[model samples]
Target chain A: MAKISMIVNGNPVNANVDPRTLLVQFLRENLRLTGTHVGCDTSQCGACVVHLDGRAVKSCTTLAVMADGHEVKTIEGLAADGAPLHPMQEAFREHHGLQCGFCTPGMIMTAVDLVHRKGHELSDEVIREELEGNLCRCTGYQNIVASIAAGAKAMAKSDLA
Target chain B: MYEFKYHRPGTVRQAANLLVKNEDAKLIAGGHTLVPVMKQRLASPPHLVDLSHIEGLDTIEMKGRSLVIGATAKHAEVANSAVVGEAIPALAELAGLIGDPAVRHRGTIGGSLANNDPTADYPAAVLALGATIVTNKRRLKAEEYFQGLFSTALEADEIITKVMFPVPKKAAYVKFRNQASRYALVGVFVAKRPSDVRVAVTGAGSDGVFRVTAFEDALKKRFSHKVLDGIAVSADGLNSDLHGSAEYRAHLIGVLTRRAVEAANAKD
Candidate 1:
């Protein structure tokens, strides 16, 4: 086993893990940070999306060792200490961005990263294109797209984005 | 993924030494392609020398007349770089269209080229642009580097450091992408440089990325989409799959090449 250290959800995390342990496995099995779901074990499903050094990456395809010495942000880290929901989360809640909720965590995570990269103003076409990685099994992309649009506008309003 | 000892080498020489010592060691850059194969049990290298710890290996800069991109440069870095956009817009655009944003954030050009996946987008650009692949050992032209599908001329211990792309007068890439994976169903890259015209095809080649000398010769006479009106590569050795027939891919080569030439001639 290799000892790995990284900052996950703004907390320094240290763990002894197998070399084959994926970042998703480390988060879900090791730390019990199950919010980053693994919908499809394959990289096709964006269910394991998380921010590695502030950029969205599919943790399912990432090695735990590869993430060493990096800062990772996940769904649990979004709203801190009984705080209100993040703008994207609120937008999803308000706009009904999910149905079965299996893909929600990854969707919200991907949406947050989208806002970070493309900024607070995003066109529907751009959102649809950028969201090619994330899949909603319920086929609820219309609502998810709507939530992201509203979420971006809300993020633009507040500094909490 | 199989268990392996991980090494984070600080320098290229150190990484090379690790490869030589371990013998079964594999270099992991961005791990997008290698890790996936390992998970599927397609490969199981006993040791992985992580390339992330090396400093200044991901820089993108203009050297003399070429844009020299460091080996570890992520697809997203190449896609979003101002120099890449200004120097070769089509190359930047090609980088942007690779995989998804998440994959782009993690996928490196060096890994992609080293793997030489036939469906990848970079090889066409590399071949058409006549780029030079700089390795720890020596630099080779794109033609000599790519051997075949899932193959490259890189020796076991050699490490790719950078790719120097000569700026073309005009260039563009057109791919009929598979909707699910966004890999090219049939992609064509057309480049008009000061010296010569080059047309490279990927995704449709059974032998991997290849140049179209017929199309190149036609463009030499007249560098216009109209000149390629009647051109069609034979379907003899092309890829035939459920997604498309070999004939269909061959036909796409003609249509896409024409469109790529038109796109190249279109204004910045």
Candidate 2:
């Protein structure tokens, strides 16, 4: 077992984990932070997206040992459970971004990072291009694109972008 | 995934020592490609050496006439680097177009070159730029470094410390990327140097990333699209799969090479 220390969801976490435990597995199974889903255990699906030291990364492909001493933020920690919805999440609800809700967490996480990198006032074309990694089998991505644009704008106003 | 021992070596010497000591060991940078393969049970090295703990292996700076990028420099860093942009904007663009934003944040140039995935974007750039790969032991020119698909001249204990790319007069990379994964379909990188012009193509070769001497010779005569007007690359030995046929890739090799040369000459 490898002993690892990291900050997850803005809280300090230390644990003895198997060498093979993935970051997503540690988040979902160890800490019970199931908010970061594992849609595709392979790296193709971004459902296990999370923030490592303020940058977005695919947790499914990141080993827990590799994330040692790093800061990881999941969807659950985006705004806490009940305080208030983050602007990105709010935009998703406002624009009806999700259909089956399976890919929402990854979408929102990826969208926030996109806004952070590409600026909040993103074009529909840019959003469509930026979302090349994350896939939504439902809704044909029309509402998702609109939600991301609105979310990026909201994030800009919130000074979070 | 198979269980293994993880070692985060703080220095290249220590990492090399660990690799030499461990019978079954693999050096991992960023773990974007390595971890996925491990999960698939395709590769399961008993000892995984994580290179992130090393200090100086992630630096990107201009050293004299060459842009020296350390082994662990992430794609995002390269993409956003002013040094890379100024030295070779096409190289920076290639780095940015690798995978997606998150993957770019985690994937490293060293890992990509070390893996030598034929579909990867950096091989074309490295080959076309005539970059010298600096390893812990020795230096290798791009021509000698890349042997074939998923192959490099690196020995088991050797670690890539830095890659030194001589700043060309002008260069650009044009990729016909896979629609979903965005791996290059027939990416062409054209570089014009004081000595000679180099044209490297990735994702279209049976062996791996290779140069187009015909295009290079034509571009050397006159670096323009019309110079390559009738240069027809033979379809033999090119890659053929569900995404593209050998003839299609050959045809694309012509078109993208022209575009790359135009893009290269247009900037300067």
Candidate 3:
């Protein structure tokens, strides 16, 4: 077992985990931050997306040791303490970006990272193309695309304020 | 995933020494490919030498006429790098088309080339652009490096330190991606130099990424899509899977090559 420490959702977390433990498993099982889902274990379904050192990566494929000394932001980290929903979260709620909600956390995390990188000027084509990793079994991704576009604008507006 | 002794080496020399010391150790760069395989229990290396902590192994810069990308540089870094964009726009574009954003942030060029997945995009670019694979021990031309699918000429203890890509006069890559996985179903990379032209195909080969000499000959004569009008690719030695037949892949080789040539010409 290797002792690993990282800042997760603004909190410094330390754990002694088996070297084989994946980041997603550490987040869900050890840290109890279960908002990061694991729909496809093979790293395809993007259901376990998270921000490591401000870049979005598949948590299911990342080893816990790999994330040592890094900052991890999960779905649970999006909103502030007793604050209103994040702009992206609000946009998802407003646009009804999800149905069964299985892929929402990952989708929202990925959208936030996309907006963080490309800003509010992301085109519909680019949004769709950027979303190749995340899969949605329902809603046909029409609302998800709409949600992200609106979310990008809201994020930019929030950044200004 | 099986338990293994993980070593985080701070330097390339330390990493190389660790590799030599451990008989069944595997190097992990980005862990995008190795982790997935390990999770599936396909590979059970007794020790893992993680190279993420090695300093100076992730730099991207232009040295003279070549763009040098350190081994551990992630796909996202390559895709968004200004140096790569200015020196080799096609390489940056190809990096952007790899896996998805998440995968791009974690997948490294060295890992991709070392793994040499037959469906990978970098092999086609490396081969077509005539890049050099720089290992800790020595530097090898791309042609001398890639041996076959999931194979390279790398020695057991050797580690790739960086890749030096020669700036092409003009180049472009066009890929037909698998709808589900985003891996190339058939991808073609075309590079046109002042004196020579190179064309490489990936994903459709049964053995691995291979060059299309016929397309190269035609492009050498005249670097235009029109030159490939009468060219044909055989189905033999091509991959046939649930996604596409060998014959279909053969046909796509010709079509994508033509498209790549047209794109390269337009970029010129």
lDDT of 2 by residue, B69-185 (tens): 999999999999999999989999999899988899899999999999988899999999999999999999999999999999999999999999999998999999887667899
lDDT of 2: 0.92
* Regions of model 3 farther than 4 Å from truth: A159-161
State each model's CA lDDT, in order. 0.93, 0.92, 0.93
Which has the better DockQ: candidate 2, or candidate 3? 3
lDDT score at residue B15, model 2, on the 0-100 scale: 97
Report the TM-score of candidate 1, chain A only: 0.97
Candidate order (lDDT): 1, 3, 2
Best by DockQ: 3
**What DockQ results do all the predictions give, each relative to the true complex?**
0.84, 0.86, 0.90
DockQ of 3: 0.90
Quote the B-chain TM-score, candidate 2.
Answer: 0.99
Give the Å shift of residue B241 in candidate 2: 1.3
